[model samples]
Target: MELKPIKTRKIYEEIVERIREFITSGELQPGDRLPSERDMAERLQVSRASVREAFSALEMLGLLEIRTGEGTYIRQVNIESVMSSLTWVLYMEKDAVLELLEVRKILEVQVAALAAQRANPEDLQNIEEALKQMYQDLQKVRLGEHADERFHFAIAQATHNKILIHLMSALSDTMERTLKVSRSKLYEGKDMPERLYKEHALIYEAIRQQEPSEASERMFAHLAGVEASYLV
Candidate 1:
């Protein structure tokens, strides 16, 4: 019987997996001190640098906390927060950002429709406030990306879907970065910001009038416009 060669993995990644397994098996617990890097490196037959890299990654994921001049310890895990952090790392690539914009088109179009159907007075007010902020930013010659994010988030909140809100929260960082890049490029053209504001205004009006189809259409058009501008 012939066996295929084993797939090679990064040493630091393998170290990360081993520690995660220890945590999963209850061998590691919150506030529990980890072995010194030298000890762990010797035990695992890897370089101390690999172990240190793994520790740094774990610290970033909130699985481990490194105190200066002290031993590393496990931290209390919040799965959602960990997942969000992971998502942020995973979507840092240009291709990933473009794919996320595609996903935004799919998700937010539906989200706008839902908002139109379910939004209360307070939700409308929140969206309107975001629009006002966007307009103010435009007047000040700012990118207004944060206001744009708030506008989309307010629409998501209007949906009242807990899972959707959580998904949006997880994607928030990547989404913000994506928008910043796109808006910077788009704003190179004169009147682009005003055009964007008009698109948002149309979407808000459709939602305020409780027209789900119109809201969805306007959302799709707006996202398509942004994507077109980004690609240009």
Candidate 2:
């Protein structure tokens, strides 16, 4: 008896599983061309759109690569090859953005703590320069948005954690959104910039002294203030 058409059988998930099985069964080896849309639709008895969507989803995960003007083909599995797309997904989702910020806050608190314990003359000078930029930008009330990102990234560098850098980069887009929302809501209040300057300075002092715990506390306080201002 002919198998029921995949389209009428059940959910897209069943389709996804069947496709995955086909790949693993060696019927669709890496670099092998997939059937054309018309052919696939006839074989599976599914609409062309569903096939296209499943193909797109697989391609997005870095499992399959689609060449424009060319047919779809199976792709070789490689972890290094997929990092950029995976990282992008981390920022593209709004809820992921909020979760990333929460993760960043926890990491930043620890970063400040570490910087406080290990910062040298150069680290202190670097952080101070960032502070100066924030200060100057605030006095002008223009909010140098690019400088703002640089300022926080500089602090992350001071932490000397390469892993943290990767994680933060994944969430950078989300952070930018929070910054815009916060500014739109509170810039008119005018007190935010000056207060943030003082907070940054206090955190810097703790780091300059190599006092990890104090630095962490100051960072938590600063982020808490930002959260209350924007989220509450």
* TM per candidate: 0.75, 0.66
lDDT of 2 by residue, 3-24 (tens): 2477454344455556666776
Q: Which digits, one per residue and each the tens of the lDDT, describe model 1 over residues 91-120?
A: 545567678888879989999999999999
- The backbone clash count of each candidate, in order, is 0, 1
Q: Lowest summed-lDDT stretch of 10 residues in model 2? A: 1-10
Q: Rate residue 193 of model 2 by lDDT.
A: 66
RMSD for each of the candidates:
4.9, 5.7
True-vs-predicted CA distance for residue 22, candidate 2, Å: 12
Model 1 whole-model lDDT (C-alpha atoms): 0.83
